[model samples]
Target: MKLWDYDAFILDLDGTLIDSGKYHAQAFADAVLAQSGYRLKPYEHHEFFGKHSIWFAEDLNERYGLSLDPQEVLKHKRERVQEIFVAELFAGAQAFLEFWCGKKTMALATNSPLEFVEPALRDAQIFNCFDVITTASDVKRRKPDPEIIEITAERLDVEPEHTLVFEDQLIGIKAARAAGAKVIAVDNGQPVNYPVDVAVHTWNDLLKLSELHRWNPN
Candidate 1:
């Protein structure tokens, strides 16, 4: 059965729900280069997205041969990201939210920090669509680790098997699967090595499911 058959939906924040993943990557790259005097390749950016920002900072320090404080570095990167997000909405993001609101018990689950998620969602006018909002800050571990997904399911009061997780990265897909939930991958140009039950090219695909009989997300 398709995921929309579930009682509730959980959406990933970055590339899955918003078109601003690249903006995030660029902001990080800009922060890294400005602080470390090195450039991050596109592939490297893909590798870092959908994970915690501190890890990105630590990775940058190690990769670029800099001896910087990871927390401080992450703070700088997050500041830049917040600035960029304030002015732009991820492409088709609003449409997806409009399609899913109240149709299902929906919420947002992301590896992004609350500072970043809250401001961005507010700016995008989607701060309230989510019945539950979870971030890496609230969890001990990030995606590829099932803690967040499992925690969200518990908070939403839904069985894991009955929850549908929408994610853009393979790591996140793995997390949802490990949590015993069905996952639909959103291909925001990043490739997934493992199998995903559904791979959508655009948020429009979620909207298209409105026509499917099995997809009564409500």
Candidate 2:
């Protein structure tokens, strides 16, 4: 559990590092309702949680008998979500990060596209904190696929086994675990069904672990 034992660190956005899932759900629901007069229910929001917006849009189109292009719908949804993000970070995320500055190499690996990531983190004033930042737009496959995690490890020159991931979504946890990293699952957003190495309900949980694990060297 030691920070120094890990070669690289990975984190998920939306839910893990930020409390923006509700905004995302609202945006998606609004977009679909406006475009096709279809309402995405709460269960549907849960189902779409960790996926790429394009896939979510396509799924909605197929489910509702609509002919909207996935890309166009996704673009609209993103614009709406951005309006809701508005220079915010998860409660306690920035202060927690301050304690670990320069202690480990960090990366942000999310299924969100670069368009959203760039603005969100920058607006939150944490764009420079990570050593690497990647999104679904940069990868051939998204979460539940190990390609992004593998690429992240490779780029950071970090062994997959020594990497630690802070993920919010079950699919993201699966993807990071599949890449051979140990994971800490954050529960600030919607709940999930994945088994995690550790479950953290708040930044305090992470901070507590950091103090206990810092000098242990794994």
Candidate 3:
């Protein structure tokens, strides 16, 4: 399907629109180390990038046999994120969102909590572009569970089948698929083996496509 064919667009926050992956990873790493004395390897941080902090904590508990409380870990991670996280949007992300803000229904669906998401959106100056914003605090489950995406679509009054999700991680892709939305894998140089309707290296590519479609009705 063409990019404009979807009734709504749902975007993931961290890696998809903003370049906040490393900062989030640092917060998680710091939390895990302080709580359980187990420092996460750099590569291991990527494995939990798009999910909730509780998932990361629980997985670490199971994998390393640590009895750390998920809530406590999450709290520490949030604290660290608040202290060190700086919001930075990927190139062309703001322009792309601006281009389609009014022409199409848009929503921000992310596994990150409101505290993390709000500042990032405001910093990027695209907070008003979304018709709805669904974060981790809004759902019982995060990405890979479909609850977040499902809630976002419901809030937008759009059908999952008619929505297109732009994601940078496997868990987000899985969630979008489970929610019955078409997927556009944001290629951030990470290898994605899963199937998607399309893949682009940056939002600049989509911006160009939107311009093309706008200028050419046929």
Candidate 4:
């Protein structure tokens, strides 16, 4: 009865697998202000969490009428982030990955570019858990487009329907579901008016697998 029906897993990097949201939020605010002369309020940055860095730049550019390049904006943020980035695994992130590693084929999909994603995963000591990893540069599109997840599934040689994705943001949940994968989300203290196959307040809920089998992610 405790058996679940997922064949593969995809982990989201930022708030889902690691506790980098706080650092990322501050760095985003700093980078945007330094580049665009527009400062994002706390509410705005909180809403911006887990989004593609390039998307953030594009949104900011459109909103502020700035001519900042998305790639440059992302690069600036990465510099700030890399200076202070330390991987703090979210609750049960390690245990969850450890529990699922051998049981399921897995990969990581993120909108973050390699400059940021690689170091975070390494610092968390969970880098080896993934069989493959994909970032924004790896695909033509990022989250909310489904391309990244689909690409990850392709690289893993797994069907989308068999891939179960864990995410922290609605954008990622939307992307996973659009790519035909079931999604489990971490609360990250954010609002989730959207639906996922499962949503848990902490990774501790991931440790409670009866919860997963109860939902039957099919």
Structure candidate 1, residue pairs in collision: 19-90, 103-218
- Estimate TM-scores for all models: 0.85, 0.87, 0.91, 0.86
Task: State the local distance difference test value for candidate 1.
Answer: 0.77
Q: Output the lDDT of residue 18, model 2.
A: 71
**CA lDDT for candidate 4:** 0.79
**Cα lDDT tens digits for candidate 3, 162-209:** 999999988998899999998888876555565634465568888889
Candidate 4: regions farther than 4 A off: 1-3, 61-69, 196-201, 210-218
Q: Model 3: C-alpha RMSD to truth?
A: 1.8
List where candidate 2 sits over 4 angstroms from the true fold.
61-68, 196-201, 213-218
RMSD of each: 2.9, 2.4, 1.8, 3.4
Question: Candidate 3's C-alpha lDDT?
Answer: 0.86
lDDT (Cα, tens digit) per residue for candidate 4, span 102-200:
777889998888877887788788888999999988988778889999999999988988888888888898899899887877766665565633555
Clashing pairs in 4: none
Prediction 3 TM-score vs. true: 0.91
- Which tens-of-lDDT digit does each residue in 1-218 have in candidate 1? 66456878888887777666777878877777877778888788877666556677787677777766767667777788877764354566677777768777987899888877888788778888999999988999888899999989889999988998888888788899899998887766666564734555556665566545444545
Quick one: how many clashes does candidate 1 have?
Answer: 2
Ranked by lDDT, top first: 3, 4, 2, 1
**Candidate 1, residue 208: lDDT:** 65
Give residue 160's error in model 2 in angstroms.
1.4
**lDDT of candidate 2?**
0.78
The alpha-carbon lDDT assigned to residue 57 of candidate 1 equals 79
